[model samples]
Target: MNDQHIVKSYDRDLEAIQATILKMGGLVEDAILLGSEALTARDIEAAERVRKGDKAIDALEEQINEEVARTIALRAPVSRDLRILLSVLRLAASLERIGDYAKNMAKRVTVLADTRGIEGADASLRRMAREVQGMLRDTLDAFVRRDAELAREVLARDESVDQMYNALFREILTFMLEDPRTITPAMHLHFIAKNLERMGDLVTNMAEQVIYFVTGEKPQEDRPKGDRTAYMGAP
Candidate 1:
């Protein structure tokens, strides 16, 4: 192939990669929304629909990874662009995990919705669900726009999500204690709350990937082990 033809082919591959990520992002956002709505409205039908589309998101992630591998083998992009491509794979993985989280929420909906004398979840659960979904929306937007500031904001939102999750834990436990009738639904809310907390973690992963794509530096993972104190001041 001539130089011009090779350039066009490479552009097409890159465009395809971008398109795949956006598709996965859109699906993930929708899963979260539908999962939350299903849980809140006690609509098992909606939950099942969300579950059915879950595989499509997984397929997209796999397809993108394959394309990225092929691009590396054929196009020989520069190191910086290569970092971005690999980061896209990481971001895709994160989004898949997010979809799994949503699926988990949906499954919990099925369980709780069918439980004996189980009603729907509470207002706090619904509010947190919406809040987490918004963060996912914003994080994906930052990725598309390549807005570092917005990405940082998304990272910051993880803390708030965590705080809300803790509160949900306490509040739900209290509700269950007050009335044993609330246990089934409360447990369902617990699963959804855990999913939202994990969603925050996944979005933070996406933000880290965004920074990596922009700077070619893989951000350090957050591991809290006595602040590395055992080795600190030892060397």
Candidate 2:
């Protein structure tokens, strides 16, 4: 009876943690959508809104921190449970960092829109944003669903975002090289692309973390090692 009760208690705690993670996931999705809108629409106000939304993400992190601390105080979490909770803490921090990158994208939006005038994103940029946003959405969904295969799928698709960013970078590079008139706006676009690339890298981190959560071990090294950019997703 005691064992059954303990198991039920642990299960309930896990569910609570999952719920908190999903709430944070929603915040990240909104940040991505709002950031993309700000850039595409050249809406400084939208950018500011994303910036404000980051505060809510911060608050969520704090809430999780407090809750986890309380859980620790009330119950003696075993090593495995400790790992799960700690992994979650790290994962949530990465997501929060991703939120900041989105805000950085928003700032770039304000700068570029002010310089270039708010018409809308070019066809190419819109396509890029759509691709990246899709990846972001899928990665978050995989986490919520605890689908390791889906997380790996997110990892495989990162090259798509990279290719899109490179292609767009080249396009803007030509703009910068051919005409000095394009320098300011082109730089703005360059930073935004860089930010998106960084954001994709962030998703990759979350995917790797998901893999750890499921397997309790790191994936085999197929790619080259010591790639700091691969792991440096957040503050």
Candidate 3:
């Protein structure tokens, strides 16, 4: 009876940790969407709100790490339980990075607000951000369901995000080359696009962690990357 009670207690602790992670994921999703919307609308107040909300996301991550550490110390979880806790750390890290990228995107809205608008560039970036946000939503779902197949599906979708980034990169480059006046805003838009692309990559990493947690093996195939703008020193 005592052992059963202990097991149940550990399970409860794990559930709490998972709950915190989901909460953090929710904040990250909001950041991504809100940041993009603010950029598209050129709403400085909305962008500032997105930036401010990042503190909550960061707080949740810190809370999760502390909870995980406590659980590990008290429960001494082994095998699959240990794997789940470790994967939670990785997922939290990825989510935090995605949040930071969203903040970075929001930070640029003010700078671009003053520069001459690049035709359709903001709209294109919003679409790209939307794609990444969708992927992150599905990745979180996969993590909760412990659905490796769903996670793998999310992994496959990242290539589409990369392709979107590639297209945006070329479009922005064309604008920069055609009008010297567009160089400043176009460059900021490109940075925003790159941030979105990196967010996609981070979402994929989270999806991969989900797959690993479920299957006990990482996917053997190389992740398909569609971003081809690296030749011009684009990071």
Candidate 4:
């Protein structure tokens, strides 16, 4: 009876950890949405909100780390439970990175708000952000459902994000070259596009973690990277 009670308590603690991860993920998603909207709409207030939201995400990651460590020390979970706790730590870390990227994008929005608008650049960036946000949502759902196939789908979508970034990079570069006045805003747009691309990579890392958690093996093959702007001398 004592052993059974201990097992139940451990299970409850694990559930709490998972719940906390989900909550953090939700906040990160909101940050992405709000950050992108602020960029496109020139809403400084919304951008500020995204910046502030990152603190909660950071606090949650710290809490998750502490909880996982305490569980490991007290419960001495077996290999399976240990894998889960380790995955939880990795997932929270990746989520924190995504949140940080979103905050950075929001900060850029403040700069862009003062500059003259680039034609169609803001819309293109918002679209890219939406695609990334969808991937994050699906990736988290896959984690919750333990659906390896769904995770794989999320992995596949990263290529689309890369393509979008590359196209936007070229567009912004053309604008910078065409009009001297557009150079400042164009550079900020380039940075925002790069930020979104990195966020997509982080989301792919999360999907890979989901696959690892489910199958006990990392994806043996690297998905082809579509981000070729750097190699082609894109700026």
- Using Cα atoms with residue i matched to residue i, what is each candidate's TM-score against the true structure? 0.86, 0.85, 0.96, 0.95
**Sorted by TM-score, highest first, which candidate order results?**
3, 4, 1, 2
- Alpha carbon lDDT of each predicted model: 0.78, 0.74, 0.90, 0.91
lDDT of 4 by residue, 1-235 (tens): 5999989999999989989999999999999999999998889999999999999999999999999999999899988789889998999999999999999999988788889998988888999999999999999999988899999999889999999999898888888888889999898888989999999999999999999988887765667767898686644
Candidate 2 Cα misplacement greater than 4 A, ranges? 117-121, 220-235
Model 2, global lDDT: 0.74
Give RMSD to native, each candidate: 6.0, 4.8, 1.9, 1.4
Scored against the true structure, residue 149 in model 4 reaches a CA lDDT of: 93
Those runs of model 3 whose alpha carbons end farther than 4 Å from true positions after fitting are: 232-235
Cα lDDT tens digits, model 3, 21-140, are: 999999999999999999988899999999999999999999999999999999999999999999999999999999999999999989988988888887788888889999999999
Q: Give residue 164's error in model 3 in angstroms.
A: 0.6
lDDT of 1 by residue, 1-235 (tens): 8989987998899888998899899999899888888877778999998999899999999999999999999999887767778788888999999999998888877777766432333566667667777887787787777777787787777777777777667667777888898887777777778778778777877887786676556677762211122232311
Colliding residue pairs in candidate 1: none
lDDT of 3 at 116: 88
Candidate 4, run of 10 with poorest lDDT: 217-226
List of clashing residue pairs for candidate 4? none
